[model samples]
Target: AQSVTQPDIHITVSEGASLELRCNYSYGATPYLFWYVQSPGQGLQLLLKYFSGDTLVQGIKGFEAEFKRSQSSFNLRKPSVHWSDAAEYFCAVGYLSYNTDKLIFGTGTRLQVFP
Candidate 1:
């Protein structure tokens, strides 16, 4: 079965510091990869995605992710962190089952930004 894993349960970073959120997926073949952010009491918002082409994909809010097939990882990164960036980050992969596509989300990584 396809699965997504976010090893980091929680992370604390000082405001203005660099941030990196790790994500790994297990699938027979490379699937559609994605990164999403969820604020408290808010729905998840798409950050970035890797469908094809370039391994490094740019996303909203100063975020970028690199898709490494060798590592089976798509790690999200930001040069600088902000207080508002604090949120639950999720790595997901789209899987096709019986011609229906569904997203399999990771456990989620909670990020806390300190001023």
Candidate 2:
């Protein structure tokens, strides 16, 4: 069985500060990993994905993540977060064996920015 879990329900960070969001998954084999961001009442936009190759992947909006196979974790990180970066982050796993390219998403992590 494949599943994803985000331990942090919500997080608050000051503008221009570094940020980190946790993500953990359970899967039988190596799965395609992705991180998406969604603003209030908006659709999700792909930040980045790790299919193979590099363990650390860079993403848009000054974000990056490192995939740790041993730990079963893919944690997102940002050197300096902007106020506009405040949104809901979801970690997802894509199963190629499935009929459709559907993603199994984590509960979600809400990011709050303080000016």
Candidate 3:
């Protein structure tokens, strides 16, 4: 079965520090990869996605992800961190099952931004 994995369960970064959250996926063919952010008491927000065309895709809130086919990774990155950035980040991959679309999400990586 196809699945997504976020190795780091938690990460701490100071304000204005560069951040990178690792994400890996297992799929036979190309999958639709997405990065979503969730803050306390808030719904999930789509950061970015990559299906084809470009390997590197820009996302909202100064975020970006690069899809590396060889590494099967779609890692999220930000040049600087903000206190508001503290939240749970999820990596999801879209799968087509019996004509139905499905999204498999990782356990999630909790980001803690210090001021």
Candidate 4:
């Protein structure tokens, strides 16, 4: 089974400060990892994804993540935080079976930005 873990349940940061959200995944083989953000009462939007390519992948909204195979981790990072970035972020691992891909998401990390 594929699973994702977001150790931080919530994080608070000041605006203009750096932010890092942690994500770890477990899978038998090379897993498809993704980061998504959801604003209040909104649907999830894909931030980035990792399938097969370079370890580092760039994403929208000034976000990026590094896929560390050895550590089984995919951590999201932003050099500076913004008030608009406050949202619930989720990390997911995808598995394919019977020609269907299912995403297993982590609990999620809620980001709060302060002035």
Candidate 5:
């Protein structure tokens, strides 16, 4: 079965500190990987995605992720955390075989930025 797991249910970081969110996936072949951020009552916004090519991919909102095939991981990272960055982060996997663009999201990791 194809699925994604976010090990950390929640994470807290001081403002201006570095941040990293763990993500692991189980899928056959190279599945499309995505990181999305959602504020309360807001829709999911694409942070980054790995389809093919370079292992490292850059994304919006000063976010980046490295796709490690061996580890089956696509971890999200940021140099400095901001209070506004506090939100729910989700790791998602998209099926290539299915035409539907639906995404399977992880339970999610809540980020709390402390001043």
Candidate 6:
């Protein structure tokens, strides 16, 4: 079994400051990592995902993440934060088994951007 951990439950940053959300996973093999963002009362939106190939992958909404095998981390980073970017961010680990796909999600980190 694998799990995702988002150590930070809440984070506050200046509107124009840089942002980084930590995400760690526990898995024996290389598993898929995903970052999703959800606005208030909205559905989850895919930020980015890492399956294989490049360790660093780009995503929508000016977000990107680098899969660090050594650290077992796939952290999301944005050079600058905007007030509209404030939302609940979730880190998930997913894989296919027995022709079925499963995803394990973290508790999520609520982002607060101050102007």
TM-score of each: 0.96, 0.97, 0.96, 0.97, 0.95, 0.98
Q: Per-residue alpha-carbon lDDT of model 1 for 1-115, expressed as tens digits?
A: 8999999999999999999999999988768999999999999999999989999999999999999999999999999998999999999999678889899999999999999
Per-residue lDDT value at 40 in model 5: 93
Backbone clash count, each prediction separately:
0, 0, 0, 0, 0, 0
lDDT of 2 by residue, 15-114 (tens): 9999999999998888899999999999999999999999999999999999999999999999998999999999999887556687899999999999
Q: Show the lowest summed lDDT stretch of 10 residues, model 5.
A: 95-104
CA displacement after TM-score superposition, residue 15 of candidate 6 (Å): 0.7
Q: What are the lDDT scores of the predictions, listed in order?
A: 0.96, 0.96, 0.96, 0.96, 0.93, 0.96
Give a tens-digit lDDT track for model 5, residues 19-98.
99999999987789999999999998889998999999999989999999899999999999889999999999988556
Worst 10 residues of 3 by lDDT: 94-103
User: Could you tell which candidate, 5 or 6, scores higher by TM-score?
Assistant: 6
RMSD of each: 0.8, 0.9, 0.9, 0.7, 1.0, 0.7
User: Candidate 1, clashing residue pairs?
Assistant: none
Model 2 error, position 106 (Å) = 0.2
| Candidate 5 Cα errors over 4 Å, as ranges | none
Q: Model 6: per-residue lDDT, tens digit, 1-115?
A: 7999999999999998999999999988888999999999999999999999999999998999999999999999999999999999999999988899889999999999999
